[model samples]
Target: MDAFEEYLMTNLPEAPSFHPVFNEALQAMLLAGGKRFRPRLLLAVVDAYTPLLRESAYPVAMALEMFHTYSLVHDDLPVMDNADLRRGEPTLHKRYDEVTAVLVGDALNTHAFYLIANAPLHNDAKVALVQELAYSGGIGGMVLGQAIDCWFEGEKLTPEQVDFLHEYKTGRLIAASLKMGAIIAGLDEKMQRELFDFGLDVGLLFQIQDDIIDATESSETAGKTTGNDEDKNSYINHFGLEGSCERADALAARIGERLASFDAPLRRSLEALLKPYLARHKTK
Candidate 1:
C-alpha cells in the first residue's frame, strides 16, 4: 500500500489547459492526499491473484481513486454539503471559486473513465472495467444515493431506507472497486459477485463509522468538516450513537466472516488492507 501510494502521488493524470489555475485546481484535492481505500481494495485483489500484473493494474486502481476524489469534490461544493475543508486542505471552491470547483470535479469525473480506457489490459477487460465503474459511480449508483440524501435532508427515514441510500451512494462504488479488480484478474463472475456483496457490507460499515466520527470528532481531527450531517439522513441521526456503533459492530463481524470465506491469498491481502478499517468505529 505504501508503494502504491508513492505510485499514485507521482503519477497524477495531467490535463493541459490554457485557463489559469485550471490544471492546479484539478490536481489539488487528489494531491492533497486521501486514504485511497478503494484503490487499495482494487490493487490488493490484483496482487493476490496475479502478482505479476500489479504494475499494470496501477492505472485501474488510480481510476477508482480519481472517481472517489471527484465525488468528494462535488460533495463539498456549495450546492451540496457546502463543506469548506476536505483531506485537511481547503476545498476547491474555497481555494478557488465555485465555478472552478465544479469544472475540476467534472474533469476528474470524465478523466477517470479515460484512465480505465487506456489501462494496459485486454480490450475486453478494459471495457468491463469502464462499464463497472460507470455504473457504480453514475446516476444509478452513487449519484442516485446522493440525490436521495440531499433531497431528503431534515427528513427522517426508516432504517431500511437509510441502508438503501448508503448502498447506492457509498456501497456500490466500494463493491465496484473489488469487482473491478476481479475483472482485471480474470476472476469468474461468481467470485466477483461474492466480493461485491462483501464490499457492500464494508461500505455500509464505513458510512456508519463516518457518522460516528462526525458526531464525536473535530474537523481538525477528521481532516474534513465534521458535524455536517445534522440535517442530512445519517445513520447516527436515525440511530443514536450507541445504536449506530452496535450496527457497525454487527456489520463488521459479517464482513469478517465473509473475508474468512475467501481463498487464503485473497483473504490475506484484503485482511491486511481492511482490518484496520473494519474496526474503525470501535476506535472512537
Candidate 2:
C-alpha cells in the first residue's frame, strides 16, 4: 500500500461491533481504488516547491481524497445516480444497504474535515484550507452544481449554463487540490490564482472527455455504468460526439499552453503529472 493508503488504514474508523458494518462499508468503498487524481495533483504542487513538504502534505492530500470519495458515495445513492458499479466493484449502496452507504458518506465527509483540521500545518493555513474545501464542496460549489444538474435533467442547457454547471460541480474541488498545496507552500496569491485556473481548465477537459467516454465506451471498460448520461444533460448532448472531442482537444491544448508559462522545472513537473490525460486526447 502507498503512504495515503497506509494512513487511511491507520486513521480511518474501526470498531468493536457497535457499528462494524458501517466502518467496514466505509473502508471497503475507500479502499476500492479510483484514479487518486486529486491527491496526486495536491502532492505534485507541493513537490514543485519542496520535497520536504511532501510528508506533511500527506494528510491534506488524504483529506482531499476522502472528501472526493464522500461525494462519490452520495452521488451513487438511490436518490442520485443510483449507480451499481464504481471502480469496477459493487457500489456501497449495492454492496451494503442504502442507509449504510449514506452514513458512510457522511462519516467520510466529516472525517475529511477532521484530517484537515488536525494536520500539522499552521492554524492559519488550516483555516484557509478548511474554508477552501467548504466552499468547493458546500452549497455554492459541488452541491449547487449537482442541484442544477438534477433540476435541469432532460432539458437542453445552453453552452454557458453547461459551463457554469461543470465549473462548480467538478472544477472547484480540482482547483482546490492545487490551491491547497500552494497554501502549504506559501506561494504568492498571484501564483496560487494561476494554479487554480490551470486546475479549472483541466477539470473542464476531464468532464468533456468523460462525456465522450460515456457515449463511446461500455460499462465494463469504463468501470461504471455508461450511456446513463444519455437521458441527462451533458456536453455530448449539446455538442455532438465529434464536437465534444474537438472541444476536449482544444481544452487540452489550452492547459498545455498555460503550463508552459511556468518556470521550466516546475512546468516540466506539472506537465509530467498531466501527461497521461494529455496523451489520451492525442489518441483521439
Candidate 3:
C-alpha cells in the first residue's frame, strides 16, 4: 500500500494526453485541483477488492476527476453558483470568459466518457461505466440535484427539502464514484450495499461540512468561495451549530461502524477520509 501510494504520487505526471487541447484542459483542472477526493475514493474501493486492476483504476479514477471538474466549471457560471474562487484560484469563468468556461466544462464532461470508453478496459465494463457516469451526471443525478437547488432558491425549504437538494446533486456523484469502483472491482451484493450506505453517510456529512465551512471559513481557508450556501437553506441554518455537530458525529459513527466489514488498511484510509469532517469541530 505504501509503495502504491508512492507510485501514485510519482507516476501521476506520467499519464500522457493524446492531444494538446485535451492535455491543456486536463492540466489546468489538475493544477487547480481541490482535495482529489473522488478519484481517491475510486482508487480505494478498487484497491480494496482488486489491486491488480489499479492500472485500469487510474484512467477510471481520472475520468471521475474530469467529470467532477466539469461540474465545478459549469457550477460556477453566471447562471449557477456564480463562484469567483476555486482551489484558491480564479474560477474558470472568472479567469476566462463565460463561453470559454462553458466550453471547458463541455469539453471535460465529454472527454471523461471519451477516456472511459477508450480506456484499456473490457468492452462490457467500459460501457457499463460510461452508462453509470452518464446517469449520475445527467438529469437523474447531479443535474437533478442542481435543478432542485436552483428552483428552490429564495424559497423556504424544510430540512427534507434541503436533503433532497443535496442527495442528487452532491450525493449522487459521490455514491456513483463508490459504486463504480465496487463494480470495477467485482464486489458482491453485500459489499455493494455496505459501500452504498457508507458513501451516502459520507456525502451527507460532506454537505454538512460544506455548510459549516461556509459559516466559519474565509474563502482563503476553504480554497473555494465561502458563505455561498448560507444564502440557500443550509444545515447550519436548519440545525444550529451544536445540532449539526451532533448529526455529523452520529453519521460518522454509523459509517465508521460499517467499516468493520472492511480490511485493516482500507479501514485506516477510510478513517482518514472521515477525519476532515470529524475534526471540523468548529467553523473555520
The candidate maximizing TM-score is 1
| Tens-place lDDT digits, model 1, residues 219-273 | 9999999998999889889988988999998998888888898899999999998
Model 3 score (lDDT): 0.76
* lDDT, ranked from best to worst: 1, 2, 3
Candidate RMSDs in Å, in order, are 1.4, 1.7, 3.5
Candidate 2 per-residue C-alpha lDDT over 152-215 given as tens digits, one digit per residue, 9 for 90 to 100: 9888888999999998888888988888888998888898898888889988888898888888
Q: Give the CA lDDT, 0 to 100, for residue 122 in model 3.
A: 82
User: Least lDDT summed over 10 consecutive residues: which range in candidate 1?
Assistant: 275-284
Residue 112 in candidate 1, Cα distance off native in Å: 0.7
- lDDT (Cα, tens digit) per residue for candidate 3, span 1-284: 44434433444332354653444544565577567788788778877677889887777787888788889988888898899998888887777578778887887788788778877778877887888789977887899988887887777688888787777888878877887888788877677666766787788888877787788889999998988875576788889778887777787677767776678866876666656665535432
Error of 2 at 22 (Å): 0.8
Stretches off by above 4 angstroms in model 3 are 1-26, 263-269
Better of 1 and 3 by lDDT: 1
**TM-scores for all predictions:** 0.97, 0.95, 0.87
